[model samples]
Target chain A: MARLVEVDDAADPRLADYRDLRDVGLRRSLEAEHGLFLAEGEKVVRRAVEAGYPPRSFLMAPRWLDGLADVLATSDAPCFVVSESLAEEVTGFHVHRGALASLRRLPLPALDEVLREARTVVVLEDLVDHTNVGAVVRNAAALGVDAVLLAPRCADPLYRRAVKVAMGAVFAMPWTRLSDWYDALPSLSARGFTTVALSLAEDSEDLEAAVAGVDRLALVLGGEGHGLSERWTDTADRRARIAMSRGVEVGVDSLNAAAAAAVACYVARARSAGA
Target chain B: MARLVEVDDAADPRLADYRDLRDVGLRRSLEAEHGLFLAEGEKVVRRAVEAGYPPRSFLMAPRWLDGLADVLATSDAPCFVVSESLAEEVTGFHVHRGALASLRRLPLPALDEVLREARTVVVLEDLVDHTNVGAVVRNAAALGVDAVLLAPRCADPLYRRAVKVAMGAVFAMPWTRLSDWYDALPSLSARGFTTVALSLAEDSEDLEAAVAGVDRLALVLGGEGHGLSERWTDTADRRARIAMSRGVEVGVDSLNAAAAAAVACYVARARSAGA
Candidate 1:
């Protein structure tokens, strides 16, 4: 069972992990080194508990501590109950959700192992926006994508905003960061996976056609600005696009990377089901 | 041709409409009464110009003023070319896009008029987040949704953040707010439209089956907190759900409203194409 600790001091040394989160650069640096991520909201924290990401500690308004007593009973982490004003002062923002949990992030599964056990996976390249990254992970979990592999330059899925936006699905979904983009392509292909890059190129096949009957597929999505690099395009088995109607220019040549990821994930899941 | 003017002061009276935009509530109130909205970036401004929402005035960096020479040649509004620092001071932020256009909101087409000419439409009920609103508009445009009808509680489509997030599709798509929700249902049904409400109710039909061979379809999406309202569900010809894979606990009952909107739009478009 988790220990309940009453904290009145806003500058407790034990709560350093949850401090100054608004400074994203510093927070990300901390995450990269310590592998600790924060999950907010009662529901998300509950899920984290159920998923075996036993919290290291919790900060919450006194009102929520009783409500979360059931979930807190399962973990041995110390729970610090503070006044709402003090909680806000410590977190540097209005903590509307009333409860928060800080958990140590687990090391991601090896890409080869994930691919071997997966039928549907998403390969994200250089997607920088934290919200989009979170949304993509949430969609992946919802639509049955087995894993997500991030290439160099992708945003940290464990970032606090990403964790909140993803509703803790980032913790649930299998993900890893690969340092080498080009080298990972052929290894995935050699594992009986078809590497399909999503693009709007003239020679690209329709997204529907590309996902028709592939049992094992890796749907590759690029960043919001510049899409997949030339090396990725050259290595992909095919490039596909969602068919768009006329008189509908959304300024960009393609959908937001996360939106595109959802569509591609859906198509791949649908095709896999049919097969 | 647009009259080129140079402004050196941030407090210029002509720039009143572009001031204090970071205060969302105040800005919204101003937009409501004045019926004016701001568009950022050269691409969105160019689209606005082409769409004939003639700019009331432009606040631009010197470099952007030179880049948009062709577009400026046809407009009759004042184009204020200022130093980047002055532009930033006037706009209350660093104008990274280097240009902004204030446009008079054109009279919205009547709901009936949009319905009369449209084969597919999206009815958004109380979708309040500017980012989600923008994303839905972008998806609606790309997926061949002919129009978007907003309920009273829906956020203003022309809100600056929404316009920016949408990549300015708010200017391209025909949209208007509806005064009556219940009364509007019959008029749509009378026009040979199939009213499909996206929901996850037990009795709801599959989205794929619900949209098969539909001529004119009105997809109704509800707010993030609540799914479709009870009134909307009662009025809908069919309540539909996107099918999820077996054995996956979605944790949440439905996709994010914007994600759901995109899926619903794509399904309707695909069905219409097949028909």
Candidate 2:
């Protein structure tokens, strides 16, 4: 059973992990330094715990404790019980979700290990928005993608906003950063996975045709502003695109990163089933 | 040509349309009372103007003038030129996008007129998130959906955040609110369209299978929480669901509203093409 600590002070040093939750830059550095990430809401907190992420501590109001009682029973971490108002004061936002858990981030699994048993993968390159990163992860996981690979410059999937947007999918999805950005596509191609980059290149085929009959598939998506870096685009084994509406003057707009990823993942899943 | 008026005071009444944009409730009432909506950024402002929305006014720093010179040349609306600091003070956030425009809200087109030439339509029910509304609009437009219909209580697509996130796709996509939420689906079905609701109901077919071979399709999606309302679910012609990954215990997890909409729209578009 977890020890319940009633905390009345918003500025208490023990609640440091929960401070300034609204400041992205400050929270990013603080979380990185402490090697911890937060999971919010009753469901996300429970999912994180169930996924074997050891909770460093939990902050919640009296009402949230009971909902998370089963999760608390499995951990020895301290639970700081605070009033809702005081919890808001500490976190700089309404704790409407009721409960939050700070969990230690485990070191990422090796790339080969994650890919060994995987036949379908989603690779994201340089996505700066944490929300997009999370949504893509959620889409990939829900649509049966076996794993996710992120370029080093991609936003942190473990960020609070990402975690919240993904509904804690970061906990359920297998994801890790690629140490090598330059040769990432080439190496994946060499590993017998058909690396298909989602781009608007004139030569790119329809997304449906790109993944047809491929045994092992890797769908590569680029950042928000630019589709894919030239090196990655050129190096991939195939380039594919989701065709825009014909006869509509959409004028340079493409589907946002997460939307594109969802469509790509769904199509890939459907095609893979037939294969 | 636009009349350029230099303003030094943030509290000037002429800037009322650009004031306190960060407050949603206040802006909603104010914009509705004035029969106006805001478009932000140089591109959005240009798009809104080109899309035949008469500009009530423009607010921007001096540096943005040249980039938007062509757009201003065609409008007689006043351009309120201010320093970057004043723009921030008036809008309650950094106007990093370089420009903002207040445009007249033309009365929504009649349902029959919007549906006349439409083949694929996306219907949203009570979605409360401005970002999701914008993203869905963008996805629908990019993937070739002919129109979008919103329940009366859905978030405002013309809100500044939605417009910005959609990258101004709201101006390009033909959309309107459904006056009759109760019979909206049945009415579309009567018009020779298939009303497919995206739901997790046990009877829901796979999204691909549900939408296959439909001539005129209406993809009905629900709000962020609790999925579709019971009335909409029961009344829709059919219910379809995106398949969750097999063998993963993603307990009670579903894709976000926008991602789900994107996948559905893409599948509908692809199937429509084949048909």
Candidate 3:
């Protein structure tokens, strides 16, 4: 059972993993150095624990304890109860979600293992926003995409903001970063997967037509700003686009990365259902 | 033409419209009182201006004035140029986007006018997040939904965050808030439109089947929290759900409001294409 430890100091040493939540660079190095990430709120904390992530410790107000008693009962981690103000002071943001649990991030699964049994997958290239990463993972989980593979430069899906935005979907979805960026699409093709890049290239077919009846498919999406690198667009098995109405004069052109993922995955779902 | 007036003081009265942007409640009251909303960044500011919004004024860094000279040349509003630090002080947040414009809020179009030629429409019910509101609008615009109608309590699509996230699509899209909440869905059905509520009701049909070949359709979405109210679900012509994989045991049941809209709209687009 989790041992309850009462604490009041914002600078407490035991709460190191939970400090400076808003300082991205500091937290990134700290989390990497210590191999940790935070899962906030009762629901997300429960999900993290249920998904087999090891909890190092928890920091929250006293009232949030009872609601999470079952989760605490199963683990021996320390639960540090603090005043709401102290929690805010240490975290550098309002603890509106009410609880924060610092959990150990596991080593990422190998690319081959992640793709072993996956028939349908998503490959994200250089998405920099944590929220978009989380949302795409959540969309994949909901729409039955078998797995996700990220380009090495994509934002960490386990970042606190991503974890919170995804409502703990980063835990449920199977994902890994690709180390070999240069030949990633070709490698997938060699493994009997058809890599389809979501792009606006002239060679691109409409999304539905491109994705129809492909037994094994990898839908590759590009980064937020300039989209897929030219090399990737040239090398993929097929290029596809969600055709948009021409209102660019009134400011309608491309979908945001997360929205695009959702639309593409839904189309994949439709294709999977033979609709 | 907008006259460029340089100012050194952040506290100058001419910059009042650009003040305390991080304070949502204060900005809400202040913007409503002044009958204005802000559009941030160079692209969004240009869009707000081009979408037929009369500009009240603009506050930007000296470096930005040259880039926006074309837009300024087309407007009679004053452009108050200031230093970056001074811009930060007035905005209470980093003016990383380099420009801000206070534009007059145009009178909303009547509900009948918005639906007159909109074959595919999205109705939002009490969605409180500006980002979701904006993303849904952007998705609707891209995926060929003709318009968006909001409940009286839906967050303002013209709010700065929404405008920025929508990539200024809100200005191009036809949208208006429905004054009547209780009979809103029924009114759409009465106007010879299929009123479909995206819901988790037991009677809910799969989204694709529910929306197929309905000449004129309104897809109603609820708030982020509890989803569609029982009243609307009961009154709508049909309750439909995007079928999701059974990963709920791992905390992946519902898609967020924005993702759901993207998926639904993409399906709507495919149906429109006769795929």
| Native RMSD of candidate 2 (Å) | 1.7
Query: What is the lDDT, from 0 to 100, of the residue B5 in candidate 1?
Result: 93
Looking at candidate 1 chain A, the ten consecutive residues that score lowest on lDDT are A246-255
DockQ, each predicted model:
0.48, 0.62, 0.70
Query: B133-189 in candidate 1: lDDT tens per residue?
Result: 998998788787889999888988888888887887888888999888776666678
Off by over 4 Å in 2: A272-275, B272-275
Q: Model 1 in CAPRI terms: which quality?
A: acceptable
Predicted model with the maximum DockQ? 3
Q: How large is the interface RMSD of candidate 3?
A: 1.4
- Evaluate candidate 2 and give its CAPRI docking class based on DockQ: medium
Poorly placed runs, candidate 3 (over 4 Å): A272-275, B272-275
Q: How many clashing pairs per prediction, in order? A: 0, 0, 0
Better of 1 and 2 by lDDT: 2
Colliding pairs, model 2: none
Please state every model's RMSD to the true fold in angstroms: 2.1, 1.7, 2.0
Evaluated at residue A179, the lDDT of candidate 2 is 96
lDDT of 2 by residue, B1-275 (tens): 99999999988999999999999999999999999999999999999999999999999999999999999999999999999999999999998888999999999999999999998999999999999999999888888888999999999999999998888899888999999998988999988888999998879998888888888899999999878999999999899988787525665357778998988888787773436
